[model samples]
Target chain A: METSVLKSKLQSYRELALKGINHYVPKSEPRKHLYDLVMDYPSRGGKGFRPGLCISTCKAWGGNEETAINSATALELFHNAFLVHDDIEDGSEFRRNKPTMHEYNNIGIAINVGDAMNVLSIKPLMMNINILGPELTWQIFSEIEHMVRQSVEGQAMELGWRKENSKCLTEDDYLRMILKKTCWYTTIHPIRIGAIIGSKGKVNPDMFNRFGFFMGTAFQIQDDVLNLIADEKAYGKEIGGDILEGKRTLMLIDLIQKLKGSNKSKLINYLANCRNENQLDNASWVLDKMHEHGCIEYARKVSKHMAGAALKEFYTCFQNVEDSEDKDMIEALIMHMISRDY
Target chain B: METSVLKSKLQSYRELALKGINHYVPKSEPRKHLYDLVMDYPSRGGKGFRPGLCISTCKAWGGNEETAINSATALELFHNAFLVHDDIEDGSEFRRNKPTMHEYNNIGIAINVGDAMNVLSIKPLMMNINILGPELTWQIFSEIEHMVRQSVEGQAMELGWRKENSKCLTEDDYLRMILKKTCWYTTIHPIRIGAIIGSKGKVNPDMFNRFGFFMGTAFQIQDDVLNLIADEKAYGKEIGGDILEGKRTLMLIDLIQKLKGSNKSKLINYLANCRNENQLDNASWVLDKMHEHGCIEYARKVSKHMAGAALKEFYTCFQNVEDSEDKDMIEALIMHMISRDY
Candidate 1:
């Protein structure tokens, strides 16, 4: 399929998921401030990738929109809630081109807003009891349970690395961290959950594991790449912000491994001193070293390899399924995730 | 029941619930930091009032310890998680005489810990599926759903009042706020959840509504009074902490109503300026004013009246049930709650 066609198809799914989230997220009185902050992220909007993937996989597996919308919305709510906390933890200034929740509000209120959204997210999963019945609800709930644990574990790993200024990290270490942090919530659980809803609890959730891992890892590497290269407007966040936050990105790891002599100590000194956005000036030096070391090209090649592997795993997992536009979109998403500019 | 015996009875129930919580709260690696911070609040030791009421009421109505333990742990986990966030939100320093979670750790990590605990709390509640089965799990889930919403709504009310610095609050406004904030989770839902578990989904949850409201309100008033009058060692938190935080306690409301001229403006100035523990010196003046207006005395009268009503409602609800030690403990708890110094 052509790239634009696949892109349009994914955008439609994003729209559908947004509508479901809009319906599910509470907007009433009292703690309306909390709910309002929750809506802030989704309303400003990202790619809506999590819920889009969830709903698409559900539909591709023979479920209709109605059957999967609640769970899809739940996934999106959890994703946004994580972003709210992540921005605070990373000390990033912006998300989706606007002030992050903690920047717009105080850190205290921002934490409450994230906490409230986490609580509100549970509401939609409980709705599964009515839509899909107790047994399937448990399955979906268990998937979410595992997803949240893995994501937080991943987040903790990244935070711990930054906190200690650990310099001994390897590329393999980065992979393991993102696998827990990004892959599970980003691809694995969404696919697993969609299949559970689509198959009415009959799907082997384990089958999607390899496919999700490859695709989500590819997506993340591309994301890190874009953080360095993409225009700030196109990226919808501060360009080179990851370096400023001293994140253990693939490029950073590769740059550290490939550099020698004065470069190594300079990078270490830069990382040790740069705890927040104030060090953006030093960020470009790190970025230049990453580019000089072929870090960007290396990451791209690895992401492309992962995307190719994902396509193979996609076929193995979806071979028995019937053909549908949703199936096509899911397959095409692998290519889009790797090749997109934003 | 003598006060000592009643206290011992409640203590036993508290121990049972604590055992369940200790078993359920996650203690594994990777996210251990998050879970460790979670155990911080519960381990420092609260009165265990919520879980004690839950387990005892469940047993009194014919539920076994096995049937009620999970829900009881869940209530406690939720309560502790709330404390973690509430401390951050209210800028509170001491909890159970130790630094607040955000005070003990950085704000970012503390928020993550609270988020992780919120997620961990759900795991035990889901265990209800195995122990209590699907139908009743849904009932318990629904009860929790309402409890979380009410608690957040109530918290929002308190936070919003402080944010706006609105002095137009009446005693009725205070009651309405506490009804959502204090009464529902602390008293009403615990009893309602206990009855549901005991009756195996057969009991009417509403019968405990009035009983819980009066009991919880009285307990809160006593708690407020103890905050002022108890020894700092016995109080387990900073004395006069609530005044410094500008909490809209019943006593504060009463003091505001009774004061005239400069006294009113002075109290308002203290509230407007002192948002945190740094203003402890100013806190004593507000506390002194509360005494001068007979505010603490007035709050105690209202508390005694509420406790008397709670005892009456207790008889109306529990009279039909067969007598047991659990029932006796529930009966005696009213006296203990109203009369205790801490």
Candidate 2:
């Protein structure tokens, strides 16, 4: 698919998902503290990767857009909910080039708003019962259950790593963390849910797991890369945020492994600065080291390899399914993940 | 219906529900930051009124204890999750005679733990598919969905009221807030859920709403009263903590209404200190004013009347059901809510 075509397709999916999200958020009183804030993150114009992936996969597997809209919207809401909490967890100041929900509001209101978003997400799934029937609705619920658990478990792993500041982390650990944290909800489950809904629960969702894992890991690595290199206007978040937060990206792990003696200790001390003092200088130093040690280049190569594998797995998973624009969109999305400048 | 009998029944039900909660909490890696903290609030030994109400109501409606256990456990987990976040929102220092989760750990860890708890609560509901079947399982999910929404809405109302510092609040506002916040989830839904399961979704759950609302409001008022007067050891929380948080309790509103001139301004100024300065002196002054202005007495009377109405509504709601220990336990539980010193 042409890049313009892909962008338009993503825009359409995001619009549909946003409509579904707005329908669920109550417009009653207490708007300022809760409901309005619940809509804030969704309205901030996310790429809608989750909803797009879900809807396209559903269509690819023969389901109509209506059958998938509610679940797609739920995925978008869940994504926003996670981002709200993740921002607070990471003490991130910006989201989508705007102040984070917690930063704009107080922690108390932000926490409550995130919670309200979570509660609101359930409405879409419950509505699925009427459209999809109880059996299929229950299946969707089960899919969401696993998605949420995996996401939180992944979050727990990442948070634990940051808290302990474990320097001796491995590539396998990074992969495992991303698989649980980013892959399941972000890519794997969206596809699984869409396919299940489209195929009427006949498709073996496990077939998409490997494809999603490879694609999601690559997507996450690319996201980290963009955080370091993308233009401030295009990235929609503060550059080098991962470094200041001491996020354990692949580049950070590789850089840690490469440094020796005083250099290694300096990197360790920078990582240990949990209070985030002198963040600009420290982040710049770490970013420079990542370049000098070829960490960023190494991450890019790994991401490319993963994307290549995802393409292979994608073909394997979708071989029997009939071809359509939706299928093409999925392939293009994978390519976009690695190839996009922003 | 003896108080001691009710105590023992509550104890048994609490133990059963805690076992279920423990079963659902993952015992995997990332123990310190997530799972262990997920278990912390439950392990602090809550009164388990929610689970008790749910289980007994189910049995009273002819449901087996085994059938109601999972839903009851889910309710308990949700209650703990709310408490975790509530403590953070309220800036509470202590709970169950110990430091709040956010106080013991950090905000990020506490928030994530609460999120994890919320995620874990879904497992029991999903497990309901086998025991209750998909149709009934979906009903339970719907019930939980509404319970969560109502609770959050109610929380939003309270949080908004505090944020605006509205001094001209009314009794009606208090009732509406409690109805959404405390009554639905704490009392109403548990009874509705249990009755639904016991009767196999045949009973009209709405019939119990009034009973639940009245009982829940009364329970909340009594809880507020206890926050001022209950023994430090018996209450398991710091006395007058609500005053320090500037919570817009009924007593505070009543005291505001009665005070004149500088006294009224003084009280307003005291409540306006969102930063909680001079907490000890301010909380003490507010408590004394509540006593002098008959605020606590007025609240007590309102609570008693509500409890009396709950008793009447209880008979009307449960009139046709057969009498059993479970039925008696529920009646005793209502009485216990108003009459208990603790």
**Decoy 1 TM-score against native:** 0.95
Over B39-67, each residue of candidate 1 has an lDDT whose tens digit, in order, gives 77878877878888999899989998889
lDDT of 2 by residue, A1-342 (tens): 998999899989999999999998887877877888888899989787899999999999999899999999999999999999999999999898899987877888888888888888999998998899877887888899889988888898888889888899999999999999999999999999999999998998899999999999999999999999999888889998999999999999999999999999999998899455866887899999999989999999999999999999999999998999999999999989988877
Point out where model 2 deviates above 4 Å: B276-278
Q: What tens-digit string does per-residue lDDT give for candidate 1 at A166-207?
A: 898998999999999999999999999999999998899999
Listed for every candidate in order, the interface RMSD values in angstroms are 1.6, 1.0
- Model 1 off-target regions past 4 Å? A260-262, B276-278
Top TM-score: which candidate number? 2
DockQ of 2: 0.80
Q: What CAPRI class is candidate 1?
A: medium
- Residues B5-28 of candidate 2: C-alpha lDDT, one tens digit per residue: 888889889889999999988778
> TM per model?
0.95, 0.98
TM-score of chain B of each: 0.96, 0.98
